[model samples]
Target: MVGVPVVLGVRRSAPVPVPGAPDAGAALVDGYGRVHRDLRISLTDRCSLRCTYCMPEQGNEWLARSSILTTDEIVRVAEVAAAAGITTFRLTGGEPLLRADIADVVSRLARITGPGGPVQVAMTTNGIRLPDLLPGLIAAGLARLNISIDTLDRDRFHRLTRRDRLDEVRAGIAAAAASGLRPLKLNAVAMRGINDDELCDLVDYAVTHDAELRFIEQMPLDAGHTWDRDAMVTREEILATLAGRWDLTPVPGRHGAPAERFLLDGGPATVGVIASVTAPFCGDCDRLRLTADGQLRNCLFSTSEYDLLPTLRGTDSRTVDAVLRACVRGKLPGHAINDPSFLQPARGMNAIGG
Candidate 1:
């Protein structure tokens, strides 16, 4: 509630009609000159666990099944993106595992080709069902994985997620490692009084499981709109906590990666911190998000969304591509979380892609 609250309604921005669509082979470049190649697609807005930092415990309306893009429609969008310049596709969601046909979706997206080559397909999941679904996903061409785990204590996990599924999550993490997935990552949102103390422990757990851990500074994307910046932990504090145990050496040339990686004690084992609040990386952002309901989001904190469901259902691929270009062209220079005039989006992280 830091910014002025806007009345909640349909925040979708009507797709603008352009004189003509940009070249089909043109890259997805915003006005700021950043060529976007990474696309985060939200398969569904429904999740298994109600994480306190993501959504509320109850009374939240879910996206209608009919409103969500079907498998065919999703493939159509990916095809358009692939034809353009998008080379990386990261499937996100309230919980992407909730999608019954997730393997099918991955198999189809893996076949897409971008300017680089065959587009890389990855996913960020809660990892509750990974134990049962990792094999199918791997066979379907999931190149990488990122699992969310904020705490190691079972009671703390239950309190944060409002679900008793830490064992299942751990099992899922194990399953990912067993599958021989390279660079398996664990994402933990750093909260001051919540999981801040467990920074080293989480890194240790990641090192033990042969997975890299990233500490993400909690942003203002909760469904309840009650995010307090003062309560959120910063990147300096996270590094300080870990530096108390090991010497964290900075890894240079991160490029467009969200996490600023550091070598723990100058070894193969490493840790990362995504300081979205204190240290914004919007200047080099090369990513775009498409919601399950077929809206293209330029930024994570975007107040406006470009509706693509109508274009997908009514027009040809060129028209859809035009909408996509327009969406990127409308991107703001940065997410002004530090600016007093900034306003939180009407939709939360679950509604947006994570």
Candidate 2:
């Protein structure tokens, strides 16, 4: 209730019986036997920066304020999801820190105890606002941080985001570290001929700051839909580039993680690569997504979403749980980005909660 606007009153419902009696109360398993325990909830579709790879520089339409989920509504859905076996909750957004009551939201969500134990709460932030918000967020039970840093060069940062906030972002990263946000992760979208030349520099930045770095392959989620496969920096290329500077070895136990982590010999530093386009780890994916407007997405590239706002507002928790389960039941085996039939979702990365 801190930052979210009050809308309709919620009607409480009894606990809904879990679907698939055989796997009842277990992880939300899809038809392909992938048990989902991680949930990414979008806080809002609005952002402060207009990164070219994420959104267009102009003519953007945000979701109606009334349509976005209220704090209580998000908590209700999270309760149902927690009961249904979700144990990891990640808050995302065009920029999650944009929410005025994000700290309050984190506090509410931290109370959800699933079968495994207390749910782990994490966030993927742009980091420009961390200097101001990190303390409250940590106090509110935010367990981890994933900061986005595409480049360290001030001019290139300006060109990429159309914003001159790189210095603020760096300050935020330092603030996050000083605040004891352990295992801090920096995510950089790898694009051919763009920041590809700065891979080493980015790694050095991460190492200097005691943060883990990951390079994610450019996906087709740009607002312009101008993603060119030929212009993408592949996982192989990233690894080779890093290998040239340091001896890299794969780390084990990467089953459910999107990033394939590798250790740099003779140092505590490590790097990860998320080859979503080239490697496709859909088989090991254990994540689900909920858009800001209460639409449930089984995959990042899902063409369709299940609206849960109406149900959350009008019905009981049981019905809401049923809808959540049904959405998981419809999860695709893979994003199918490599398939010739793949089509980009209408919503851009910001709208989709990446």
Candidate 3:
């Protein structure tokens, strides 16, 4: 994870190709005609953690520095996405902090100039290196942070991820809060036998730290493909487990964070459930993923992709806009996280920048 300096911060209003003028395609137009507001850009395909739900079971070779996107190239892609009406720029990766010049990249994105559009920039990381990086990120215009912490048990953490940076992740959370990461979010995947008993404990921890803790379903993304109904700790069960211990007040959302949030005790700390399996909210979904390897994935379930790097490096602004628009038009309404007919892909979450 210590491979590159990250370029953080993205400007949403930078001049970019207009919609369908010449090269602008259907990317600006969604199924419901709402312009794309959020863009997820993967910075690198390298990661240090080998979480069971993410990386390969045996582990794979990490990407070299040369193969990852450059600062200018990443900004160009963000500019095109902003031109396509994307307002939220999330720097994601196999691990975003691994990319060199990430801070520079973030700064460049923040200065992009487009009329009447101000973008919010953020990053999602494994939190292995946030302690030393949060200050630089905030100084460069990072708006918020999302730290992925799956469980609290140290041994289970070791079993799930081959590393033992749990303490580092905690330190990162504290450092991020002190460094202006307001309302930090902690994304957790609740495994059936792994950490399901810690549901109430997780809520308590969230309340204690004033963090938004979200319990996500165990996805069928890893190459193992061993997910079953037994492995899935449904949303209803999660809610019941938490509610039985503490009173919950359902929290309403605006754009829908893909998680149904609820205040644990009518306070700032909230507990959310991302029930992609028990209850899929694909209809109101609005998300797109760009892999670190330059592939544009419309849906996490589909292995298919629309390559954007070729056009990104050679084409004019119009051509880039057209390709992005085409990819957006091709966005699926929702993903079948529960349908039995949908055989999930073999790639793990890390492969696609979860």
Clash pairs for candidate 1: none
Best candidate (score: lDDT): 1
Q: What is the lDDT of candidate 3?
A: 0.72
Task: Give the backbone clash total of model 2.
Answer: 0
Q: How well is each residue in 93-159 modelled by candidate 3, as lDDT tens digits?
A: 7888977788887788877645446677888998888888777878888887888888878888888
Each model's lDDT: 0.88, 0.87, 0.72
Quote each prediction's TM-score. 0.93, 0.92, 0.87
Q: Which stretches of candidate 3 lie over 4 Å from their true place?
A: 1-27, 32-34, 61-66, 113-115, 315-318
Model 1 CA deviation exceeding 4 Å by range: 1-22, 315-318
User: For residues 1-354, what per-residue lDDT tens digits would candidate 2 score against the true structure?
Assistant: 333111121121211223452244556777767778899999999988899889988899999998999999899989888988898899999999999999999999998898778998999999988988888888889999999999999999999999999999999899988887888999999877779999999999998889999999999999899999999999999999999999998898987899999999856789999988888777777899999999999989989999898797885454777788889887766776876778899999999997
The predicted structure with the larger TM-score, 1 or 3, is: 1
TM for candidate 2 is 0.92
Candidate with more favorable, higher TM-score: 2 or 3: 2
Error of 1 at 109 (Å): 0.2
Q: What is the lDDT of residue 320 in candidate 3?
A: 61
